[model samples]
Target: MGALKFKFLFAFVLVFIVAIGSANIAEFDEVWQQRAAMAEKDAEAAYDPYPEQSRNRAVEGRNSTRRSLRGYKGACVATNPIDRCWRCRRDWARNRKRLADCVLGFGRKTTGGKYGRYYVVTDPSDNDMLNPKPGTLRHAVIQPEPLWIIFKGPMVIKLNEELIMTSHKTIDGRGAQVHITGGAGFTLQFVSNIIIHGIYIHDIQQGSGGLIRDSVDHYGFRTMSDGDGISLFGATNVWLDHLSMRNCHDGLIDAIQGSTAITISNCHFTKHNEVMLFGASDSYPKDSIMQITVAFNHFGQGLVQRMPRCRYGFVHVVNNDYTHWLMYAIGGSQHPTIISQGNRFIAPHNLFAKEVTKRDYAPMSVWKNWLWRSENDLMMNGAFFVKSGDPKRMAEFTAKDVITAKPGSYVPRLTRFSGALHCTINKPC
Candidate 1:
């Protein structure tokens, strides 16, 4: 009689929990539906300067015949519309800021510091952490207002500490060889509207804490940094492109603490343990608003894992070439929505790391509800992905009609200029 009573009470509690969960799901759906309607209304007039009959932004490049048939190419066959739009131009080196327009995926809306005046970096030395040289890369980043920073010559900046970037700046390294190494790397914290492009950043080590200046007028006592190649903390509308990174102590790129509207494209990442980390900690639930696009990058030799370990945000991993990885790629913990579309994942010979995705700190029963989709992805040498999420819910969430991208097989041509380009004065970039 006692056993029967216990079993009956357990069944009743389970049924009651299910009923409550159903009610919560209905409420959540209704709220998201309202949000989708608002997003549709906004997207109709969302900063599109060249809108034709189609709803796609990349249609300009895809429809042009003269731009596609530029010099030094056989038909100019490429997959990524972003690179096809700008890289084919013979005068790309002259109009370097035109790259600010060649972005796709979620972060296609970012327009980084393009309207700023040019500030040339003539000094390569990073002698003092507190007092930086006026014409150095450190000083250029901390300037007020929007500024487009360029280099005078080839430089190797061994930083004394972290190079913290101010808001509304563009570190353009085209037509010059630039490298930041042997110390802490770039840090983007509590800033906005920035672009970092065409630089080689590697061998970053952890530095001792000191009084460092972030802006032109402000200085504060900073703690020891984690030694990431490019760290973004609470920043928005950031674009990192065509950078070559390797051998960092921590992650190569980390966008944490509610960082949003960011794109990392056309970069080459290698020789790192944790390649990119999207969220910092698990308890910080505010990171749910983070939406990042990782596209057209080459994840090449000597990478261990976490091509990106996401958390709580929406991540679009599109058209990137993953040539090597020792462990599993693309990880997350707290139910981050990951859409891995048109990526080429080449699995290594390691037998234990054939899977392309890993859900950290969650079991099968719990993580099976997370929205991790693999659409039109090319898997070679036994690479595989574990997909989940309800299709109906995913359709409701990504309700905005966006442009469609090409598949992952053409990643090689799309990423032809993946690393830092060596542009001459009289030649194309």
Candidate 2:
């Protein structure tokens, strides 16, 4: 009887152990399932196909308002001839007052606290093109003051001539719209610490009169010879956010002459030849360092020839979605340290398609421009290129050799979200 009791007890213990093991397995499965579901939701949010019609409508309304104001001055003169005579006598006085009001805000620095520490300069009449005053406001918001320039209505700045922007400014659009309707070849040069946010910048083409000679006799050629938009030369620490740029000849954003620490974020770029460019002429080797960060942007239809050229500096391109690109989306000099990672690139044909191939530009580099693609990336283009060397044998090389070795160090480890893990072997999902 005692032997029989022992056998029965052992059977009960074995069954108990099996039950506990099953429970643990079930818990592990549940946890994995929850993680998978969350990942799917996040991807869906990032790649939502819905068009932003409302945002586009808001931009259009502002553009229309600026066009109406441009022709308003002539109408005022024609409608009131008698009043015009009186206005002409006090024309200089009225002009000075109007100019001061438009540029200097009626002798007051702040706009009655409606805007933050920033100032607003929306009137085209407030052009300080010939001689930009030390503290006068222009299309840019002067910084350290944190001013907001509400283009309260749609407006344009027709550059009768060139304009010079000084340093330390922030141009915060309080949701007011602005347009640049003027000579395409006119340039706004020499600016720093500028923040151009929430504005629709488009449709200004190149003009006649071509390149204008500066006071120093250095010909200031327009970016596209006659195109109109913001161009940064020797500028640093600038932030351009929530901007919709399109239809310019050169590029939406161009950084030349070692423009460093610039951030272009949350912008929609389209309908342009070369949406973004860095490095103008490689003649000045010292001026090649253009450290730029481009993140959270959407690049859609009508984008081609986008990227920096030879001898540029560090560029961090992350968290952006590219819908369609006509040619090689990114191609340039081998010297620039480019970090292309964590982005969703969707192209109908071969992605990362390129015309030329070359060796890595520099030696002794670290995460200098490492690429790290998260498992969560919905789409991945062509196979990432690396130097022909066994990565696992890296320990044999000296530190200097390791740094100089052309082999790419980082390998993307993708974590699949669902039962579709088998489908993601060819591409990350």
Candidate 3:
């Protein structure tokens, strides 16, 4: 009888551990649900944000909005909704915190350091890992309080180790040209509300294992870094916008381990393979809660595949220009739900890679049931998307989760200023 009781207790403990593990992995489900609610409001707004650009006509699903070009005068033409939020303003430097309210899509709630004071990064050195200089970018990101981090001048920071970040921080490289290259990359591990904008992250090499300060009160030994430009592990409410990224040793951006409520927008990606990876492993079932938005970015030349390769998540690819791709543009496995809307796919001359979508590690019998839909996307040069799954399953989605297509022709106008802009102090960005 005692032996039987021991076996029952062991079974109960195993069940409890599994339950706790599942809950821990999906800790950001509330964030994901909130973004989905925001997506509904985004659909009804018809891309109208600025009062000056309010004349743009609202249309039905999959129709183009008539943009009013009358009163808009300047070199700053904010075509997309995200750009219209904060661009074309002369006092952007002073009102830098306003950008925290401009984020859209799954990362709509990411208000990185909007409430905090500004911290100017005067030094571009990463000589120390344990005790960072006060005026350095490393120190600004590690502070306990929220901070709007800006650069003093244009500089290149080749990191000595992976720049592990804390929550509620914005690396706003607007007034200056900042470059992170030739060394380790940024790591967002178990944090929230981070905005990395207007910087160039490329040529990232792996960092060796060492003791690093991740937060104001924490110092821990970190393993050798993967050479991704930005690696998000169990992070939420993150926005990556208006950055130029290329030629990383591994992926340019990778979000895994149940990271959600993220958006990658208004960026230019070139000369990279495995550009973005949303989910890490097939065995990580917790990754099913991952949700990301890829919008208004220019996927330019020298990109082979995986403009984003996804797994076990819901990805919204909207209003991006895929101008060049040597291989297939989007690939997925492990039953990810990919909604491709209002994107332009200009396929390479290679006929074998004309298809925009590629399914991996599964036969047609298995992957055919995955929800992959291409709505109002311009399939140029014989590019095609193999759509699957039941269309009626969309009825199960909430209003916020529903996306109406804006037509692919608007991609050029939406993603016109895709890369990091050279913004003058009193001029529009």
Candidate 4:
């Protein structure tokens, strides 16, 4: 046999072996089929948050409301149509639940407080974390059944401990100034179907975690928390929107330990060391099934690292305006699949941290097969993304057909309303 023919045969055998390995890898196209199976089992659940006529229009079942937010009560034309969809109406404060219809992303399946009656919070106190008082934020969060919680007035609450939230709840802060600050923050653990919107959460301190009330009927001992603005542990189907968060002791948001079907949209995060973290660690195999959508947010001002550091999951970061960063931006480990689409990243003037990506806990020799990709991303002012992953496998991602993200230049328009919004009555917000 010719030497060239022998080399060709050897290459073919190597390709076959690697193809088999791709079948078992966590950060690849195979996980899309896994998510589809989960969706099939929960088919009875309805996407009824949207009007029947406008269901499942685009990627991630997003049916965007293309309503123009201009010309209502002399309101200026808005850039983000999603933020304008509900608040543009004259009767916004009256029909507050309509904000549920405005959500557009992967966690859009969340129907939080959709089936519950409204509960108004008149008190601003968090006197006790273990024994909550009625009419307080703590009391509302500890309720067992579904609730649409709203604030009656402007108030700043300093929590004594973690505000442990129950399942099937919505803490909607429309028409009021609500701030959860100066102390420990939220702990969302082992729950599902929750929505947190239009609030300011910042300046968090770590908790000496002990017995905390999660629900009216359930109170359990908790270990010390890491002081994240929002900590999601083993949670699913959660949505966070229109929040202004900064200066937390740990990450601004940490979704770990099998948290799936989550979305973080239109939130402003600033002045933090570690920013967002997805999946817990590479050792947790269950986290391989996690999937999250992060879209239409602003990673602005005083961020050190980890725009999101992932481990064993599929995370889509799309259409975000990143105006500042002290260190590198996106990162991953444990072969997590990251699809960065249409984000504007402006690196700090520092030369050492100009790269926008980092792969932790793995060397290139072993991590090259991980499926990390960047599409239509705008890196400006010397910013760059060091991409790694299987290019062929990334192209085959099934979620690509469900939701097509806009380009990075559109980040400015998408993240126009990137924090807690104060919508004036009879005015488009």
Top candidate, metric TM-score = 3
lDDT agreement with native, every candidate: 0.75, 0.41, 0.80, 0.75
lDDT of 3 by residue, 3-86 (tens): 999999999867765644422222224543453355333322322122122122221232333323224355787777777879
Ten-residue stretch with the least lDDT total in model 4 = 43-52
- Candidate 4 Cα misplacement greater than 4 A, ranges: 1-78, 398-402
| Clash statistics: count for each candidate | 0, 11, 1, 3
State every prediction's TM-score relative to the real structure. 0.81, 0.51, 0.83, 0.82
Q: Candidate 3 — what's its lDDT?
A: 0.80
How much is 158 displaced in model 4, in angstroms? 0.6
Instruction: Flag the better candidate by TM-score, 1 or 3.
Output: 3
lDDT tens digits, residues 1-429, model 4? 699999999998667645433112122233334433454333223221222123233322122222221233544444554576675677877777787766665687787887898999999988776679899999998788899999988889898888888778999987687999998888776577899999999999887766666667655555566788998876778889999999998889998767777888889888998999897667777677677778888888788888888998778787777788887888888888788887888888999988988888878887888878888888889988877766776555444212456767767666766788877666655
Sorted on TM-score, best first, the list reads: 3, 4, 1, 2
User: Candidate 4 deviates by what RMSD?
Assistant: 12.9
Cα RMSDs, all models: 12.0, 27.8, 8.3, 12.9
lDDT score, candidate 3, position 353: 91
**How does model 4 fare in lDDT?**
0.75
- RMSD after Cα superposition, model 2: 27.8
